[model samples]
Target: MNENVVVSADWLAERLDEVTVVDVRESWEYDGIGHVPGAVNVPFDSFRDEEGESESAERSGSDPRDAGTLPGAETWADLMGEAGVSADDTVVAYDDTHGVFAARFLVTAEAYGHTDLHLLDGDYSSWMREHETSGDAPDPDPTTYEVRDPEHSPFVGREEVEAAIDDPDSVLVDTRDDWEFEEGHLPGAVNLDWRELVDDETRGLKPRDELESILDAHDITPDKRVVLYCNTARRISHTYVVLSSLGYENVAFYEGSLTDWESVGGPIETES
Candidate 1:
């Protein structure tokens, strides 16, 4: 497990020149409070939508705001290229959302076969709290990314998720908060709020033993075919990294999450 991929604010600060610090927050958020000195802004929204102009999605009347909506590999490649991220550069992504958006950027990058990625453990807020400092954003340099075909990646579609519900070896994890789970979630999907696996103060992961015990209590073993989902498929990125770090090899991200499930009249369970 390369869990060391997550580095502290000080660690990143020390190697500021070595790794490319990427701010994954929205443009407004980036401009509002500033960012890591010399860090480039690559809003995580680009991974979900193509700058509000998804041709395929537009024809389907699909809102990019939906959880499962992700742009094609070419579009993602172009966006990353625009962000001035070279393939060989070590990428360290951060955002205000407790590293979820940052994780989303990493996972999406992995789909393109880019592996040398890291997360700024506490994100910008964490940095502000710990180092008591802030930095200004820089204009991104445009660089081409040699993207691997995303068709070979590990993302899951709605139909596959629906079918996984019946697969004996598979488990569907609703990675949203408890309230959202109680409202409505995919049938047979077990609620496991992504937050339970994280430390609020540090914004870092819980111990391996603790995470293991928590997941084991829910029968979410490492060998099971784990399918994880959340409201907009962003927060689920946190649990994805958690599971991956814990050595879950068969994990998959269900992009179309609860919203898509409900759109198709899928069966859902409710606490109330």
Candidate 2:
């Protein structure tokens, strides 16, 4: 049980039987193409239930919040159990675009006391690339799962963010598309679109050289309190995982992102 990180495909492949690879990509992604052999398909969308007057009930372009915001510890336990996972089982999560959903699953699993969680370095595309000759399509498992969580879990809120922003010592980042950041973002926020960081053509994170160049271009110093955010929260969570996996020591995700700010009547600036 790796409490605080993601693992590589080669490492996971060697221990496939010991680890449970859970694919959090959409049903269409799994249904249209294929998935890891013997992997479980859990839709990221089903991770949440809807609320009032919120168009977010239906996925939106700028929706930063994912259905899979880490729920209570009990809820987390139940989700894993239903997915045919035990607390002691090593779990690996993956998604199509970025690792955010997978990270969420990993973190939620961690919060639920299942520390052995991992993220596939890239995603389904990366898996397909490595196993060019393999085609293992998995049917979603039919099981009753329950996620349990400790009542008092940690959460990052608006006030804390505001304080951080005011502190001048914390580095706040918006991990969304460039257009979304340009559309309207928190003051002093820097843009690092998750897409540019990954190899779109290959469907994995950019090579080490490319990734280093990107970070270097951004002048992202190693020692800093890095706080990542997005329209909602999933993307940032993934970014947090990515940065952490890269040996970043102090990184955190703003769980309730821009939408939460807007919900609080916060101001937004439009591009001219």
Candidate 3:
């Protein structure tokens, strides 16, 4: 499986024994309803900072952005350890609600320079339907995991996003729903809902040819530097993973999405 890409259910089912699967649902969903057999339960919130919020123009250092902040460095490592994840392990993450939260986990992992991470294709709901053996995943043996700044990172800070807005060759995509896009969006952003990248029936990413066709029709070409954002950045990261898998090497995601944009009083536009 390609690291930092989406993995089909078939690809994952065949390699379950070889990789570590992380379920990013909350405690109630995981410990209550159940999860993929042998999957580790890593609630999505673990990666976000509950205390330290991100900076916005309105609050500056005072108000945190709407998106979740990263937890402390060692704290991230411990969370991985609790899931029995080692630095070398090929990890796959999923969530019941689309791949939003799951993608966040992968993005956070990428920030820490974790390699070989994948998002399970289809939402967790479909996976559970087919697998049917949902229950508590065994408590994983603790292991040491390291967090470091990678030589190259996939995140786009507010400053970089602002720069991209002015670069003619760059494409900034707003990955929120149509209603949200109509309500308001960042300046010069093209609206492309996150759902468009995946098949509704299968909840799996569209084939490359199909995806390319759609993107070409929308003027989202691979040649341009791409930046994505949503209200909370989760949807943006999901699209980021899909685009990266499609060989988009120069892509980045704005962690502070529209809400953050609004927070800073960034210029916005709406449909007439």
Cα lDDT listed for each candidate: 0.75, 0.64, 0.77
Candidate 1, position 67, lDDT: 23
Best by TM-score: 3
Lowest summed-lDDT stretch of 10 residues in model 1? 56-65
User: What C-alpha root-mean-square deviation, in Å, does candidate 1 show against the real structure?
Assistant: 3.9
Model 1, range 138-241, lDDT digits (tens) per residue?
Answer: 77768988875433355766768878999989988988878888988887888898888877887777777998999998779988999998866777888887
lDDT for each residue of candidate 2 in 64-98, tens digit (9 for 90 to 100)? 22322444444544565566766666678888766
Which pairs of residues collide in model 1? 68-255
Question: How many collisions between residues are there in candidate 2?
Answer: 24
- Models 1 onward score TM values of 0.83, 0.78, 0.88
Error of 3 at 270 (Å): 2.0
How many steric clashes between backbone atoms does each model show?
A: 1, 24, 1
Clashing pairs in model 3, backbone N/Cα/C closer than 3 A:
49-69
lDDT of 3 by residue, 187-240 (tens): 888988888888877777888899999888777898898988887666787888
